[model samples]
Target chain A: MTATQALVVPRGTGKTHHRPSRTWPMTVLGIIFLAIMVFPIYWMINSSLQANSGAATTAWFPVDLTFSGYEAAIQQQGGNLVTSLIIAIGTVVLTLVIATPAAYGLARFKMKGMTAFVFVLLITQMIPTIVIANALYALFNDWGLLNSYLGLILADSAAQIPFAIILMRAFMASLPQTLVEAALVDGANNFRAFVSIVVPISKNAIITAALFTFLGAWGDFLFALTLTSTPQVRPITLGIYNYLGANVQQWGPVMATAVIASVPAGLLLILAQKYIAAGALGGAIK
Target chain B: MTSLHVEAAEARSRPRPGGGRSRSRNRTLHYLTRWLFVAPAIIFVLVFFGYPIVQNVVMSLQDYTTATFYTGIAPWVGFENYAKVFGNPLFWTTVINTLLFTVGSIVFQFGIGMALALFFKRHFPLSGFLRSLLLLPWLLPLIASAAVWKWILDQGSGALNQFLGLFGVQPVPWLVSPSLALIAVIGVNIWLGIPFNTTILYSGLQAVPGELYEAAALDGAVGWKAFWHITWPSIRSVVSVVIVLGVVYTLKVVDIILGLTGGGPANSTQTLATWAYQNSFVQFLFGQGAAISNVLIAVSLVFSLAYLYMTRKEVDE
Candidate 1:
């Protein structure tokens, strides 16, 4: 109830606030809503454990759970999961390295065309991934980047960098200008000051950016589908897509693969809940 | 924010007693270093976004194909790609489907999201926990969600059919049938979209002062009337942002459709995005794909421009 009270009570009001007794019923209804909304995810896990019936005879629950689906999924998609992990981590590193400085520059700099640059970043988010994929396919083909990890890492980072910059810039913009200036006055250069001062203070925003970048890269399907043709560089997303392509007599392995693919998102949602919430608003409203 | 900008500017302009030439050189160095901060990102945007947009335009006008990759001989067709895209009978179906999918997803997603937002705004036990848990659908990979929903909506022994059978209702072919495929896909999209919409709108609702409701109630402006006069006007800007962003995101949705129905039962759910994918990757007709995606781009550009205009207006006000 303390959490509920914290949510219900507005700031700066010290009065004794009492929730009506009826509000408890609202909690039940809220749970039902969340249950419905999240049932697909539950079903994903449930069906993954059911025996390979090869038909729509999955029970409502995994009453007789089996590990064959997981064994099959790991045999099939373990490498792709690793590929996705490496790409996602690489995207996070590249995105933060490129976007963090740019975010700080745009936030603090009084340079000309900064607004125009920000405008362009905003516009980039609106462009469909297919258009980028179409052109990147031809470009990657010409540059010999097709079916390469670097190719996918670069493409996925491209999609995420703009949003990362925007998210971090909103946070960095609020940093007191004097914080960096004091370091500059102490004879540290801009880069050094940013490294020492801005980066540490903006840790929350940076992590939020990194988390989202990782998620974006992990969940990327079009770039993987378009840029990589062979199984060598396939991410688990495309792995699942291909699993669906086969006759799919048994969905056990498919659902197991889904559960595997969803671990990062689900884990982050639980562990980094505050950062994710901040990002959910920051990425959109800012 | 403006005050901080002015303060930073004043700090920068404060005089230092130095030789003019060295000062100019130092200033130049300073600007160069500033440019270095954003240069990589600018280059990335150029190569990834700018070049692709330009290349897509150029490709859309040519006879580019898988053969073009091999021969490097994409003859200039001079709008023939667009002509082909426009002339194809499936073109109109895609256009309508795209419109319907985007608009339908937005409408239901926003509506249900707003309702949930209002519901959660009330003080209730475990409300915060439930609301946060609601983000699971949106957080999961679209393909994963699509896979699960595909099973749940499977006609034979899918959970939905099984559940409906309890009421003696016949199995509904959610994804297989052409007539219902689009609606099913949109329903899944709405399910995916609700968490985001609800989270944003709930935050917006939270920002509305509680005092307004307390004051409105004294004048009998409670419940729906209070919401209309107080809540609606307050969250109008957030609503617009949500709607515009939703449209832009929903406009180019490819993963869900491809995973669920593959835009099929004879192309019933083939939006411009999927069509573009089919052309470029599936059929290896890069030019036609570029042309179709360019159309998608133009449609998204309209909404993006509207968003920019709205934000600018908000700033001015």
Candidate 2:
């Protein structure tokens, strides 16, 4: 599908018209399918709660529940979690600040070179993160950005900003042009009008962009793996990798750390379901 | 609202007292201000994406290494790095592994995703909820998923083995065995990719007109025949998109392999991406790594061009 076609087709719009009569049976089947697919997640949680002291003898259920794994994971990975949180928030802010205006421009301004700019944005999605990391390592080294939070945040923001622009621009393009024109006529300049009008009206798109950006930066491994040479700037992903490298026998804490690391995604999935759904489609087709 | 509209109309009709030169200058300032909106993004793309790509090409030719970091001197070595990479026997193994991994992951992910998408197309209670929940695996950090799968595929006490042992099967060395490591890594990648494939394909299925299916039912086109004749043709565009995007993505998969196998068991599971990573970071052979990654870039560019062509065709249609 073309990008515009994917955006134009409303999600699940056809479902209400032709509701199947025998849905419960299908629902049961869906639940089964879901269980099989998410079994690894269930196992991760179950193993996290069990005391598998350097052994593979983990109980299917956490019958003898223990907090020891949590204790160890918290003690070891807690700081990394904080570091990841800081970087994720930084990436979200940086990406949105850079991308929001660009989205508005691309949506509103029919300027020369806009099509080419949009094409470049699409091409950026195809560039591999390893390639970026490959060159950034040397650049960051020269610039003294290696092994720093700013360095990681900047790299992650570069990764996410293009996506944020494309996703948000799709939404902004559909917005009524008169809204901003109205603001401009009321003596506000373009930037002021955007700040007071466009930003407020585009809250949903902005939130979607922010959530995805946060998730992208939080889950980033390549930049954290390549850019940071020292443990002082480790994100939780690297924390888990380091844990795996050092303590393969201790599955409990490893699983516990995995569970801890998944909190943002899980929280967003539950609390921001609609936005997450919008983002899933937006991130892919756009 | 009425006053705002009146003001907007008045502003449009009002003529500036300034001369042509001043008005033109004002217009220039206005355009430049508009340019400010996208200027940062442009600069960012240049530095991050454009500059890196160029730097990779340059670095691949020079003898860039860890010592270059300390000495600040990378003498030009010309195609020596590329020669070393292509001459090595492991390069061919990596090339094959990369192909197998991308194809295997995309095929299974797309097939199973299409199946799930079709199943979910039927209206069902809680189907939406269950489908959304399936995104959890894709949402989690790749390393986190890798860690969980690493434990689950553990030979001794791993859950897969324990489950298999119920039928008198021996524990398989998934990541340890040279032959099986690539397959195991592919399996985990397939698991990670399924949700994205399903979500996109399911949305595509949703867009398929419901009346066509009803018409097909009337004409006795049901089950596989109905799907073959109607559903597949309708969603062909989306399928091409999903497959092409999947190829582009699966080609550069590094985190999962790094997390799961570290391209180990004597580098049995190493793909070009991971091998480049190993060359650069693990071995401090930045030039060779850049050369390998440049080759990966070229391969990706082919598919990326195909994708752009397909999408552009889609737009034209």
Candidate 3:
């Protein structure tokens, strides 16, 4: 009972031992983890700003922050920054229009074999682009759709649909069925109920689905590389490829382009950090 | 009193089975409306999604090579393309390389994610801020991350090399080395994947009641013992889901490798994904590429089915 006495001495009753606080250790570890996560991005920004004076060399910080790489990348890469922006924006629009309804369907409907259908949707998630790369290239050639905006949209859409469905389905499934039932009782038809009741309630899911699909389409490269040849339709990803020739890889401009293109996703991450974290965790756990 | 009782019985049976059948007919109409909502998506998939997948499989068996082109005949090469696949040492090499990448990514990614989750379970200052920041890598487009890493790992003058030089280590040829390239790319992937795994495992951990740990501690369980006995059981379902998903994801990953090395250094870092592309597109061996992809598809299907089965069983139990 001597050991018990030592444990009980804190409260002089039956209380456990009083331990010292662990605040500082946790804080230090948390800060270290943050640094590890943020350093690469910090390095990317710093390197992107460095001038050509030390361009051939490695320096962690910029000798002088210059916008010349950005200027050069924009001026020389393709038609203009406008073209790349337009293509990205267009991709986002196309992806949303197609993905939204599909997600709604998968989420709300208790269709026969819907679970199997979802499994199929998930299965198609990331079919190696290489598998159909040649045949697709050939098919596009035959149809004269190769390197066209329509072709890029179609290819990107194919990949986006499955992910959109999964995210949207989960979102829809979480909505209270009572509200939808109320709309039904009020004599609102299925379509009208979905539009006025179910959809408005599930706006957050819709937005998240849009954000996920848009980002995926925006950053796509392989299909962009294989599908499009002309600069007229090239997104920033493939546009950056021009800077990377067979021999000399232009690190300065490549980094600059990467920094610019990454801004939207970066900002979106911070803005929607909570939802993204939730979605990321929820999707993984489920 | 008898008349009142008869009236009550009629009222109770007013909505009969016949009426219920009519209600179902109305529901059938509602169900048709639901189909209408989902029909466009189905049509889109059938045309662009289903058609191409089926076409790709069919085309994989044909003699679609240039040799058959001049004759204008694609002769039946049933299983010959598959034979060519098994016969090639390169194909087997790609499979091995892909497996290594997948296994390495899963272990490190899950390990780091689990560690972060455990750490975050404790109430700490700026834990929320740290969690938010970690989402950057996973949220960013793979292209952007790959591009940034490409710059960071540049041999001649990259930040990674500069950082290494501080310790007097020579600059390593990250992308150029066939031996190091897959691992190098995998390292970046792990970085991208850790945040995702952390987010997932963290959420799963949060759902675990504090009472379980309190009870375990009362019984003298502490640290790893507590975790194995209490924490593991609580999060087992989520962990199983994550592992199966990790496998499927790592199997399908192509963009990172494509951006990093393009499966170069004599195809040393070539994965099944990249190999499928190379054979089908670059070599104009569409049949071979399709076969390789089918192999990937088959493997992925098996994992999905297994995960579904396990998850269903867990739910039932």
Each prediction's total of clashing residue pairs, residues at least 3 apart in sequence or on different chains, is 0, 0, 1
Please rank every candidate by TM-score, starting with the best: 2, 1, 3
Stretches of model 1 off by over 4 angstroms after superposition: A1-20, A53-56, B1-19, B313-317
In model 1 chain A, where is the ten-residue run with the lowest total lDDT?
A: A1-10
User: lDDT (CA) for every model shown?
Assistant: 0.86, 0.88, 0.70
Which candidate ranks first by DockQ, i.e. highest? 2
Cα lDDT tens digits for candidate 2, A1-286:
7554566578884455344656677888899999989999999999999887347467788999998899999999899999999999999999999999999988888654555677678788888899899999999999999999999999999999988998898888889999999989999999999999999999999999999999999999999999998989999999999977764878889999999999899999999999988888875743
What's the CA error at residue B153 for candidate 2, in Å? 0.3
Candidate No. with top lDDT: 2
The reply for model 2, stretches above 4 Å from the true place, is: A13-21, A53-56, B1-19, B313-317
lDDT of 1 by residue, B100-163 (tens): 9999999999999999999888757777788878888877888988888888898888889999
lDDT of 1 at A215: 91
Q: Model 3: clashing residue pairs?
A: A130-B277
Q: What is the interface RMSD of candidate 2, in Å?
A: 6.3
Candidate 1: which docking quality band?
medium
Q: Write the per-residue lDDT of candidate 2 for residues B80-156, one digit (tens) a residue.
A: 99999999999999999999999999999999999999998776777778999999998998899999999999999
Minimum summed lDDT over a 10-residue window in model 2 chain B is located at B1-10
